[model samples]
Target: MGHRARSRTRRNCPSLQEQLVHTTFLEELVFWTVKFEFPQKMVCLLLIMLPDTDYKEALTQAFVLHYSRISMMLERSTDPDTLSNRVVHVSVQLFSNESLAFRMAENLNLLHVMVISLKYMMGKILIQNTLHDADKNFHYVVDCGRQVMKEHCYWPLVSDLNNVLSHRPVAVKFMSDDNLLEMWFTFLAMFQGMNVNQREMTQHVEYEPNTYYAAFSAELEASAYPMWALVSHLIDSSSIDLTKRVLTSCLIALQDWLDAINFTHPHMNDSMQVSFHLPLHRYFSVFMCQAIKHQGLSLQEILPPRDVLTLIMMHPLRVQCFHWFPTFILTITITIISSHLISSHRDMERMSGVTWATISLTPLGISDEFMQPGQRMRD
Candidate 1:
């Protein structure tokens, strides 16, 4: 009976070992299958997210799916404050799709107002960059900054503007000019009645070091057209000596700004680099044309009709260099001729009354002969 029991135990052990080996083989196969499938899944996800086909609905669906998973994770977190802060961060991360992020942010009151203010501030900046009205843009940015201060007691708004002034000295120079004087006055008025540095203005996050600096850098580097226009004006209006001094300083500042914007270390990819030379040249050309028109004592002497024609002829070679060159040449020619014709009443009246008839109607006209292909062949 004992021998029979031992034999039965041995038989059971062999069957158990065989079953374990089969389970281990199945586990290895599952692992390999998952590993092979994940990259393909990611590729499909990227293809679905591609913007070329206007798959906004699909993108929104994907965003919803991602946010649902995030919501579940947030629910599982132990600390409520950590979850609140994370919600704020998630809301901000969603800002790439601003409309959706804003919808999410609207429901979350647990986060500090500072984060909301930053979102609004970023939106204002985006609008200002695209908007046509400078005054309106300024008002919007300043108002958002003021609101941030009022709601969150963040004086970094002032600091942000100050840092922008320092880095883009042109903004300050232009802001001091007559055109922007009213806006500056308005800004001063808004801040005057309140405490400049009221720490307890509202209970909010403490000031982060370099907050203003980072903000200014991001704003300036993102768009430097305002700064460029301001510097160009200074260069145009100043006296010769003053112009040279200002230009030298402006160029140095501009170079620094350009480097800051466009600098790409080896770690950065090609798309990360910025190139502003095309825009700079276009603006500078316009500035030069305006300056010449206003300051030149004798337009006829400076650019005669023949000179204008020559300039127009040279244009074809440099077509890629300037878009407005032909238009400007035409305007300059017309201006010079008008100035000449206006000086003499007799010449003006003689040229004005009779429109010249096209010579194509005449038998000897070359244009008519060229139009008649048979005649051209005979000739």
Candidate 2:
């Protein structure tokens, strides 16, 4: 009887309240599977709960149609609080297609979405470092986040992309520590669009701390242009000048975050007296590495400066050295990569002309020497 009921839910298009009720039951079943030491039960529960491709597509259309219906309902109401209550009460009583919970989510902020993601990380410092919705097991928060943002509002969110829009740091709305973390990661996500759209795939899992890699090699083929259109719209650039403005906006936003983070503030909490320190460069480089590794759509290709590119490429290798090799060995590793990139004139030809100039002008930061007259530039 229990299995038959579950099968019925699978075969039918459940109303919104019914879906949540079923989902809640499934969520509980997962907990019990773990409690009873049934690993396969846990995996089976998760897989079954996921909407298949056709269902996902159908659910997407329903979400947009529901949003329009909601707008009409809100507009007709004389008192919003009373209307919200009536709609919610009726929806629950009837098990209506419009769930009160989904309606309430549209008002949530980006920070709220990120906290959901953090919960799934199991209190680890590192995430699985993925951006695709297909990495559903790894990135559960994104689905919920999308629900909160709503597909209908995706365009509107794009218009307000930058929390900081200028270099002078004008007085802006105060954001809390958690908000700052969301902004940083979301910015990284935008930069890693290529990786999200095109990458080697990971697979369904029996357990997690899931595999970071898998065997599927068929290419995830798509351009980042439409997403780029949203970004270009964010900055209000003319179509011809879109690329330059987008890059400038990103660089400014990066600097803005770096300025906001209180370096002295103890960020990470642990049982021990010591807290894990996130290095200054790692924040930049982690996102940079994701962007750098894109073979299909190289963000690194358009961005200027050979020295910056050199540092971005070396970050992953440096991390490997730090983790897998000794400090002295890491030192030698950096020295070799840096020398080969900078010292060889023939090797420099692969970089743009502007990049070569930037490299030539950079003094390698080795000596405490004074700048030449008129050479010092504004920060």
lDDT (CA) per prediction: 0.30, 0.28
After superposition, which runs of candidate 2 have C-alpha atoms over 4 Å from their true positions?
1-24, 33-38, 45-182, 185-249, 256-362, 365-379
Instruction: Give each model a TM-score.
Output: 0.19, 0.25
Error of 2 at 349 (Å): 19
Report the number of the highest-lDDT candidate: 1
Which residue runs does candidate 1 get wrong by more than 4 Å? 1-224, 228-242, 246-280, 295-379
Candidate 2 contains a number of clashing pairs equal to 0
- Model 2, range 1-379, lDDT digits (tens) per residue? 5345434433442221223232444345533432333344444444452347443333333332232233333333344344444333322321122232232233222222322222222122222323212233232112212221222222211222221111111101112122333333443332221112111123333343111111000000001212222232223212213333334444444343322331121121211111011122233322222233321224334443544444332323322422322232122123223433333455345343433332321222212232222221110
Candidate 1 to native Cα RMSD, angstroms: 29.9
Clashing pairs in 1: none
Candidate 2: minimum summed lDDT over ten consecutive residues — where?
Answer: 214-223
Write one digit per residue (lDDT tens) for candidate 1, span 285-336: 3333343444332322322234223332221212212221223222222332
